[model samples]
Each structure stands twice: as structure tokens, then as C-alpha cells.
Target: MCLISFFSLIFFSFFLLVMGISYLFNDFVLFIEWEVISLNSLSVVMTFLFDWMSLIFMSFVLLISSLVIFYSREYMLGDININRFILLVLMFVLSMMLLIISPNLISILLGWDGLGLVSYCLVVYFQNTKSYSAGMLTALSNRIGDVALLLAITWMLNYGSWNYIFYLEAMKFDYEMELIGGLVVLAGMTKSAQIPFSSWLPAAMAAPTPVSALVHSSTLVTAGVYLLIRFHVLLVDTFIGQLMLLVSGLTMFMAGLGANFEFDLKKIIALSTLSQLGLMMSILSMGYWKLAFFHLLTHALFKALLFMCAGAIIHNMNNSQDIRTMGGLSFQMPLTVSCLNVANLALCGMPFLAGFYSKDLILEVVSLSYLNMFSFFLYFFSTGLTVCYSFRLVYYSITGDLNCSSLHVLNDEGWIMLKGMLGLLFMSIIGGSMLNWLIFSTPNMVCLPFYLKLLTLSVCLLGGFMGYLVSDVSLYFFNISYVNYNMSSFFGSMWFMPFISTYGVIFYPLSLGMSMTKSFDQGWSEYFGGQMLYYSLKKYSLFNQIVQNNSLKIYLLMFVLWIIILLWLVFIM
Candidate 1:
């Protein structure tokens, strides 16, 4: 029954595409509107609509969602409440449908937050300590970023109409849109897990394989990229957008390091997601917005397939996540083994794979254009690192000795999951072959790189091969902490140290302290309220009592306190 509903969803989305396309290419303006309308309304959403960019985003989101739902039936099946899972799965798709189809920023936020909410529910559906904690981390980190976005919206709303295009038009940086845009970039960075909020992504491995496969690998992380692309006009200031590029590039480097060392199967994919999104931001920052979306499209295919394959391995092994614990199932699961190897190679940008076309395109754009010297070097290094880790992920999972003395994964998930990803595998293996026709041959106002094409190809191929050849050696090196001690030297781009440390010092201590302050805060909360000097906060649970469901009284009191502080600060200024 779940299988039937899932296929029905896919067929219905395709039916929507055919119906809309049958009449869309009528007139130029009509064609534009129809493109947006078809994508947003793919799930039968009548009120949802946008322009060409949104259409591109919507089409991929719909495709990934449908594929994940189809996989869920066989991937999880009897182990879960199939009916509820399917319903929630539909809710996930519906939320994304609402998010990308809407033409207004307000509608976009509703859709964005809704996507985050449903994803949390899905990630933590098992209600285990790990999943629950991961969900909470995701929620908390994203909510803080969401607040920044809300602040941007409020700032923008103080100026003009409540339409997305109004803000998008204003993105050209009129009189006051720059500050608001800068704020939006901050929110976008956090939502996209550029760096500070990126930790939650790896922890999200607690989610079932398909959810991790779809949300992190494709839809959710891409939301930030979409936001940046949507608001590119206001990004004229390098000083402002510079932050976006620096953060994204460095995050890719950081996460790729962890990927280089990580032993957990799912975390490897999580790290790849970080770098992939980082590359997306890199492209978007350089004004190649369409290419970023195009990269996103191809990434969704291969990454989803990769994660689903990892899930199949986990299910087969009865929930073993450590790659070191398994080996030599290739004979038993040759199809899966073959698929996994191709996905890894594609992920590392091997020839003709999905990643090759998209990844190489971004590289071409960066190297041939005004992409900064620092970004250029970091970009190449990061891709090399990506290939190394991609090799490790495949190596550790398939070639080692089996340690399944107590493990119990399903023999095979059969076709429900396999069918969902077969297309992705094929695409990852052959996507680059069509790049000349689909991408390279396109006529655009922007100039194409015509000279030194061979140098460009050499850089990409060399970076990838260097990564693959010594992955085993890199693995051993990472284990010895040689790299961690000299991380700053290796990455060498600390452009935001002053600001990141000023406000974001919490990450360092938290990463090392293991919630030391959390324990301290819990221990001191009673004393804080019990003291007569503490007239503001009530004496109760610090997080829950004061934060989650705080009353109108508390809000107003906090407002007054803020006003008083503002008055004092004004006098000092």
C-alpha cells in the first residue's frame, strides 16, 4: 500500500509536468510564468508559483522527494509504521512544494521553515537518543538562523510590498536593501550550514538512510544556495558577499577534513554534503547562479543514490554504521557494490559521472573568470580532498574484513529502493557525456572559457586522481593528528577570525568541552533565579521554562529590558 501511494505521487508529479508543459511554451512572458507555475504546482498546489529559478529548484525538489518516498517503502517497510511514515513523507514533499513554488519572501519563509520542521520530525521519527538529539541540534541551529532571516524580512517589510520580487528587485541594492541583504546572507549561511551551523548535518545521521539521503544531500542544504541565488542582485559588494564566499570555501575545507578522517558510514556522506554545498556557495558568490543550480541538480541525483546505497548496506548489516566492520559482500550484492563504486567515483568527479559535469563546470568558472586567487587555490585543494575522502568511503565499506558477529542487516531491500536510485546511478556514470550539448553549448551573455581548455581539464583530472591514489595513506595520516595540528596552515584563509571569534567563540569550547557550559548552566540556573538581584527570569528550567514556551509577560518584560539597555547604549554612543 505504501509502495502504491509513493508511485502514485511520482506519476502524479510527472502528470503535472506534462500537463503544464503541453501549454507552457505559448508566449515569452507566458512561458516564464508557466515555468514557475508548473514546478511549484507539481504536487497539485494551486496557490504556489514563482519564476524560472524557482522552477529549476522546484523540479529537482519534487524529483528527489518522490524518489525518497518510493525508497521508504522497501528501505524501512515492516520495521516502521508504514502508513504513518508514508503520510509524513507526503508532508515532507508538500512542505518543499509550498517552499519553492511561492512567489513571495513571506511564502518562501513559510515553506522553508515548514521544510525544516517536517525534516526534524522525520529525522527523529525513531525517537532514539541519537536521532532525537540530532533533531534537536538541527532545530536549534536552524531556528537561530531563521530568526536572522525573520529580522531581514522585517527590515525589508518596513520598505515595500510583501512580495518576493519586490525584495528581489530591491536586491539590486537601492537605498536600504544592502543591510537587509547582508543580514539575509547571514541567515542563508546558517541555514545552509556554511560553518557555524554545519555540525548539525553530520549528527543528522541518526535519521533513517533515505531521509539523510534526500534532505541533507539535496533539498535542505540547497535551500541556502537558493536563497543566495534568489538575492544575487544585492550581492554587488565584495566586502559583503566576500563573507559568503570565505565562509563557504572554508567550510568545504573543514568538513572535507572530517570526511577524510571519519569512520562512520553516514557521516562520510554528511561531510560530502558540506563540501558540495560549499562549492555551490562558491559558484553563487562568483555570479554564476545558474551553474550553482545546475550543480545542485546533478548533485541531488548522485548524492541521493549514494546515501540510499549506504542505507541498503546498513539495512543489510542490521544497522552497522562503522565502515571498518564490513567487507567482501560484493559477491553477494554485486549490483549494489557496482552502484556504490560508481557513485563514489562520480562523487570524486571521475569522467562522465554526474559530478564531473557539474563539478568541472564550477571549476571552469572559478579558474577562467574573476574568481579570486585565494578562492581558486582553496577550491582546487578542496576538490582534491573530496576525492581522497570519497575513495576512503568506498574502500572502508567494501574491502575490509567483516565484523558482523552481532550485526543483522537485511539481505536486500529489493526493488522499491533500487528502482528509485537506478536513474541516479546511470546519470552519475554518464552525466558528463551530455554536458557539451546541455551546458557547454548554451548561449549566454557571459563569456565562455575558450582558451587553455586543456589546462582546465588537467586540473580537474589531476585533483581527482591525486585524491584517489593516496586515500589509504591520507587515512593513516589523519588518524595520527598530524593534519589537525596544522589545520590553519593547510587551509590558510582566516579572513573572518576577528568577527567569528568575537561572537562565535562558543563553537571552539563546545567542540572540545563536550557541553561543559551546558552542565554549568544547568547547575547555576536555580541560583541565578533564586538570587534577589535576578528580577527578570523565573525560577525554573532554564531552557524549557524560560525559552521554549515563555509567556507574553516574559516577552514584554524582555522588550522593556532591551529598550532600557538601548537607551543606555545610545547615551554612551
Candidate 2:
């Protein structure tokens, strides 16, 4: 019950941090707590693992968490337990705060695991079946990542130096470091939902709009990308770094494949986030560390805004999330609809949006990565896929035949959420000009002209317009009763979602059946054919059964016989 508020938490964390920064700026041996783990704190105040990087990360953490808390007050005004919510928010922010400054392996793991575990609570805090499963799935996926990171730390200590700073420093050029680097990338892959890890993000749509806003859309999932940002120098020199590029490229395409077909309000955003993260990973693969972090910085702004706006829609529409059920709300709830659409257009990377600033820079970095020719293709293709899904999301959710009988003219959202969201949205629209292109983008790289970028938008726009023509054609062909979705029935999620509902549904049982069959075959083979001689030993002698099954006795006798022969050979021969 005794919990520090986010404001107080920020004040304390920052107070320690500012002192550390001042110490470092003054050319002193300044230190700060870079890691705290397993109830063990060096507790030396701000003199453990301090650095400018940690300081920068601290600043963004304060800003984002403050914004989320601000948004939470309005979004959850009448929440039955606002205090508990605030407590969770503080813990979430604190854990991240600890993570950014963690100086040791154990401390990093503490924050990493805590961040993942707390996220599940946030995702499922609403106590609904959908969000519960979604949170569980995300948590489980994160557990896989946690195991990899833990193993990596253990392996690093087993093989090299046990110290955290040493391993981090050694990894920069150690030829033997790829083993841990690969494991860390694997951990990143699962957390960021690259390729196979992509499904959990879409499933996480079961979360409340605000939780989704904070977790999947904003800061939580980006933790993986942030890890990449932290490890860029080490990874770029290893084979695993190249693997990151491929993984990022494939995830970008995968998101487009998933989101283009998804019509759910949150799922589209979820998939779009995945796709955008792929963009960040792709940039990180090229070793644009600061640019990747900047992309992450701006992405948090726009993604959080979109998720909050989506929350407003869900709260108003009696929790209906299907985009097809939300057409033309601009006429009824103009402010909310406009906010959501702006978020959508921003995600689509329309000019002037926060997404535009970040995405253009990411693509530009990819272009300038003199790493090789293939990298250019990967960047170009990733950009094309990015635009594809972004446009699809914007058009489908706002310009369709939306008729949800459950919907009411709900304007329940309070000032805190609106203020937080508007501040972010305004930045999403105009943050591009304020950014440093040279830091992230390639030096003197040729980018698409304004007309060409516009042309790309027009092509995507035409595709979006076609989507309008084809939205919910099922209404014309069949009754709602006939189209009633039985997600739990034989064909789950319409036999889509390649892994969970489709492959797992069929292949998991098939795998069990195959195992049973293998067991049966082994038993039969031993009894009748492969071991028939054992069963019918000695032509039906009474002692045969006992001898057949008694390997210990048989081996003992053989050993004695062999010893006798050896003694005989020495003595007689």
C-alpha cells in the first residue's frame, strides 16, 4: 500500500541521475546504479554505473512515463482502483529506470524480467478473457527471451570475464562473443515480435486500450529495439548482426502480410507497431545506434497517441474493436475520430507526423549503410512494406460502414488523457524538422523527392480506396447469423494465424499422435520382431524368461567368463 507516485519516483531517480551527470561533466570518477537484481542493491546511491547514455535514457524514461501517467488519469478516471493503477505505473517506470542504469548482469536481468512480468499484469489488468490470453501469450513469449538473456549472461561468465562491464567491453571485438550475441539477438527477436514472435502482439489486442497504448504500442515492446540500440557496436561486427538485418526484413514483410488483412482496430495498430519495429531493427542492423534510439523516441510518441485514441473508440463503442463495425464515426464523434485518424495517418508515415520523421530517417540510414548492395534492397523493400500496411490501417478503420449497435455517444475520456495524447499527436505531426538527419541518415544520401514520396502515398491511397470498396462484402452475401464467428470452433480464427490457431491447433495434436505411434512401434518391435529371440529364448525353457529380462545377471556372467578367458590365456597359452 505504501508506494511512491510516478512523480516522486521520477524525482528521486532523476535527482540521483542529475548528480551523477554533474559529476561526469566535471571530469570526475562519477558512478551510478547501473544494475540492481534479486533484492540485492549495491545501494551506493548514484555512484555505481553512471554514464551519459544512461542519463539520456533516464530523461526519455521520465518524459514517457510522465506522459503515460498523465494519460492514465483521464483514460481511467472512474477506475475502481486508481491507486492500484498508479502503483503499477510506478513499478513499471521504476523497473525501466533500474534497467537503464543497471551496472551488472544480475541487475539488468532483474529489470528485464521485471519489465516483462509487469507488462503482463498491465496487459491483462482489465480481467477479460481476451486480454488475459493475450497477456499470457506475451508473457510466455517474453519468458523465452528471458531464458536466452539469462543463459547468455551465464555463458559469458563461464567463458570469459564474470564482470558485466568487462563482457560488454570485450564483446565489442571478441571473436568468441557471437555465441552470446546470437543468444541476445534471439532474446531480442522474441521480445520485439520479429517473424515467429509477431503473433503475440496481435493477440495482445485483448488488453484495455490504455494498457495496449503503454505496453504493446509505446515503451514495452520497444525494449527489444532499445536493447539492440545498446548493443549496436558489438552486434554489427558479428554474423548475428547480419542475422538481425534478415530478421528485421522478414518481420517487416510479415507485419504487412498480417496487418493488410486484419480489420480489428487494435490488431491493425499492433501489427503496424511490429512493422515499424522491424524498421527500427533494420536501421540498427546497419549500426545507426542513435538514429535507432531516436526512431524509438518518436515512435513512442505517435504509437501511444494512436493507442489512446483507439481506447477512446473502444470505450465509446461498447468495446467493439472490429474496424468494419466503425465506419464514418467522423460525423458523430468528430474530435475522437479525427484524433484516431491522425494517429493512423501518422502511423502510415504521412508527411509531418512523428512517424514520418522517424521512418524517413530509418530508411535513409538503410540507404547509406555502405555495408553492401543487398542492404540497400532490404531497406527499400522494408520501406515499401511499411507504407503498405500503414495506409491500410488508416483507411480501413475510419472510412468504412461502421454500425455497432453497442456504440453510444460516449465522451468519457478525461482531460489528463486528452492532454497527454494531444501533446504527443502535435509532436507526431511536426517533430521531423526538429530532428537531426545527419546523425541517423547517411551522409549526402539521395532520398526520394517530395513528388516521389507523394506518388508512393497515392499508390497506397488507391489501395486503401479499393479496401473501402471491399469492406465487409460478407454483409451482401450472408446474414450475420450465418457469418457468426466461432473462434473456438474447429477452424479457429478462420484457420488463419499460421501458428497458434492453425498450426498449433492441428500439428500439436498430430505431434502427440505421432509420439504415441512411435511408442507403440517401439514396443511392438521389441516384443515380436527386433527382440523375438529374447521373448522365445532357449526354445521355451523355464529359466529363459528370467534370463531374457535380466541384463545385470547376463552381463555379470559374461564379465566372469571374459575374466576366466583372460586368465586362461596368460596361464595356459
Query: Using lDDT as the measure, which candidate wins?
Result: 1
lDDT at position 66, candidate 1: 74
TM-score of each: 0.77, 0.73
Off by over 4 Å in 2: 1-30, 33-52, 158-169, 370-378, 400-402, 410-413, 435-573
Error of 1 at 18 (Å): 4.7
Clashes of each: 8, 17
Model 2 — which ten-residue stretch has the worst lDDT? 487-496
Looking at model 2, residue 338 earns an lDDT score of: 72
**Residue range 70-174, candidate 2, lDDT tens digits:** 777766767889778777866777777777766555666777888888888878888887777677677777778899989888887665443455566777666
TM-score of 2: 0.73
